[model samples]
Target: MQQAPAKDRIQLVDALRGFALLGIFLANILIFSGWEFLTDAGRAALADASAIDWQHRFHKFFVDGKFYTLFSMLFGAGFALQLERLTQRGADGLRIYRRRVLILLGIGLVHQWLIWDGDILVLYALMGLILPAFHRLSDRALLAWSALLIFAVPIAGVLTVNAAGWPPDAGLLALSERVAVALGAVNPQDGVTWLRRTDFDGWFSWVMSGPIYSWGIRLMSWRIFKVLGIMLLGMWIGRRVASGSLLNDRRLLWRVLAGGLLIGVPANVAYTYGKQWQTDWPSLIGTVPLALAYAAAFALAWPRAQRVLGIFSFPGRMALTNYLTQSIICILVFYGFGLGQVGYWPPAAFYTFALAVFLVQLLLSRWWLRHHAQGPMEALWRRGTYSGRVTRAAAPG
Candidate 1:
């Protein structure tokens, strides 16, 4: 008997993803304005008595770290759904997946160099290359690997630094120095380099030639292991309960809520004060727990979210297009190729700009999806991979 088609592509997951996408914009607003907003000295410059203190505090408390964690969880859930479709096809899932990931790598490389400084698509694509290896692992094995990756990355980082006899605070100091130089008021050179990077060929060069041969491969390799672990966790959750069904599982929801609050709240506090206090270990520890708390909370809340976050579902359904469109809009607003407003706008203003972009995309996505089956990029990917021919025609909704 023929198995029925997958149910209209998991509505709640899409909504959660859309919700995550909005948060991602909040996380990225600073970077979108200019590269300087994220650096230490830039933040210090923006944190004066005349600066908008409440806004900064709000962003730090609500936007930082939280949204990225949300995005990663959605990525994990999406990866599981991909594996389900592939496995049912009885094909070489890994080989096909590798090709798709390579395409994504190509897309990300272009996006990173041409668009913004905080591009995570390249990282995601790189992670995709190795996720298939863990696709077949048992739940226990998957959990073990996830735990190892989470613990091993930072531990390994610290051990390697120690082995090299580097100063305990060397990395942080160097980063601080870079920021200081950039924000020194008279350092025109640093400002110029920063602008050129975001506006010209510098981004392309960095992605293509600069150190891709060095730590690039290693970073991608490690991220793969990390992402695979997350993907397995999502799969485990999905297999345990069907969509809309998890809402009734109050005991599980309570467990998730507790785990998230227990870890997430404290970690966030530490991440905030620890940075201010210049305590490296606290920041590192806090970041890890925060990542876990994110997964736990999302897994718990998804069932309850189905009704609350309907608007986000439309955008999430067309995530690829929406994501890419964000870059397009940012370039138009800030690049030399467009308005060239680098170093001109404040962090708070950047967020306002991001909000406008979000609203436009949200409306556009809703309208576009009403008439078509896939977002523009998603349609291209479908045709490119399956037909080996580029079909420009959009699919009907």
Candidate 2:
């Protein structure tokens, strides 16, 4: 990527943040569409070959898993930046980081149990809590740990799933299957579409149904090892960025960019087809490289794509607020707990709505950042995080 324009400002991170948010919206639309696979009737309803084929191909090959991993990288990098600042000032980095992460966990708990079940906040927060443990590791050690965690856990999981009579065999897999069953039984906010009973009742049911989907399925099937691994990998990348090692090594960056794509594209292709064989192995191995490829590609193209990247930078800067609000809007639009419009739109329509909302958010975020120092949620997080400490004036980012 080009120089960040200022010492403290890293606009490439913001662009990637915007990119990650778009991908997240796209991935979560399946839930907003009220897709259920538990019954023959529900499966039959979703069985339009023309409606699903292209969309499935697009998501499987491109949109699935990759962007979230990118987001994870940003998360780690952000923390690395903050910790460096704290350490330089002789501040208690762990306490400050812990408080901040705990606040994130609190927000995630509410988001997870009260709003939507598809929330990733809790997982990120939980993982953030353990991130500092890696702070002491050297660059090489950190990368090694990341690679070990990312690759090792998934292979172990798949093997366990397959090996009959293996100890703890299918424990995670079986639980995920059971959670899936429960998820399909519970209808989305009493199954209303294009209408509502009452706002109060709608909200009441929405709250009631939150945990059933969130904890029952989302948390149950949570891929802790993989996410943690990615986050750790992100932490290592963050260190590289903070150390200026990555930015200085243009040759290495291009090599990484080329290598990631060369390996990742084909790996994802295998993953797309691997589903037919009932395996997660391909995705477990492929998603990281694909995500790295996307980041490197964007960095390489940033100068040429400045106009588009500039547009994305607005939403990227206010990622936390934009991300949370997306869930709010989707719940209102699709779930019976609000306007009661579940299953009313096609896949493309759902994604289009998400894009339309994000476009509005992009404009609004641009306008908001013009005057305010930060987005609403981010401001609150900072205030809560540094409440008892002396703080500096906001940077002119």
Candidate 3:
């Protein structure tokens, strides 16, 4: 087999990635700024909804489950692309990918410690460890395992609830209350300070002193499984589209969306309805279907959206640098590390800030790419992968 040229990287796929990056940032702003716990009046636009504490309701309807699901699905696609390249070169793709995941694990740990505890990179790294093992499974097998694994944790949780019932385990409940209380006590303006303490002392304490018992039980639970399932779906999409086989398939694109909506909308709605039952089973069952819908919708969106959202391509091209930059900016704006405007900025305000960041990134990324081969992080990653073949890009003067 002829080796694929290095310059053959697809622009449309990068554009799609950038679009997913933007969606991720929008959903993440709430968690980044600590607005996830704020009162409805503190953020919502609707007066009646705010009065009734409709924050979760609104988030669920829009950002909550949707954007992150898109992001995770993209990761899966990315993995497939990577493996395809390695396989074409007759290299051990799994071995190479594991090294990369190890590197990511280290990066994620640093990110969580110095930046934010909500870092998904760490989760991705942990999940990536098991992914290469599933590379060759038939699509149906992949889908089945994806569904089963995604639901397993939540189902187990539901079963535990059935067995134990009511207000949670006494010991766990007490610990959760303590953690919640500490988190609640921090004023928004003190977010930067919170970051330092939590990222450092809090993280260290949890890693060293937290029970192995908890980790053992929850490590492969539903949340992790759902993400893994998404990654698997992404692998399928990446193999199909990133490989350039689907670009000319215009009819396939519409079919993708129609099928996704047919399956996704009803599944997501059913999942939402199940949530109203106030039990774990309904949510678990509902989430299983919604996960499938999310994968389909994203795959369907890409080829169709490319021509429409081509401009976002550059930012997606530099995703690593941009993702890290977001953390840096948040630390500067909300923490004592810089301006420390945490609690003062409501959730709605983050949307404005996010827009500003996006605009700046979109312009800067395009500008940088005009004069450079790759983003700084991509260059560094290349240097890591190729040994001495290339040098890291120097920081801008």
Model 1 alpha-carbon drift over 4 Å, by segment: 1-9, 35-60, 89-91, 166-193, 196-228, 241-248, 274-279, 288-307, 388-397
* Candidate 2 TM-score over all chains jointly: 0.85
lDDT of 3 by residue, 24-56 (tens): 788777766656544545445323444333435
lDDT of 2 by residue, 21-111 (tens): 8988888877776642223354346556556666666788788888888888888888887788777777777788888899999998888
The total of clashing pairs for model 1 equals 1
Error of 1 at 46 (Å): 5.9
Sorted on TM-score, best first, the list reads 2, 1, 3
How does residue 275 of candidate 2 score in lDDT? 40
Q: For model 2, what is the error of residue 218's alpha carbon versus the real structure, in angstroms, after optimal superposition?
A: 6.3
Judge candidate 2 against the unseen true structure and give its global Cα lDDT, from 0 to 1: 0.71
lDDT of 1: 0.59
For model 3, give the 10-residue run with minimal summed lDDT: 388-397
| Highest TM-score model number | 2
Q: Would you estimate the TM-scores of all the predictions?
A: 0.76, 0.85, 0.75
Question: Against the correct fold, how does model 3 do in TM-score?
Answer: 0.75
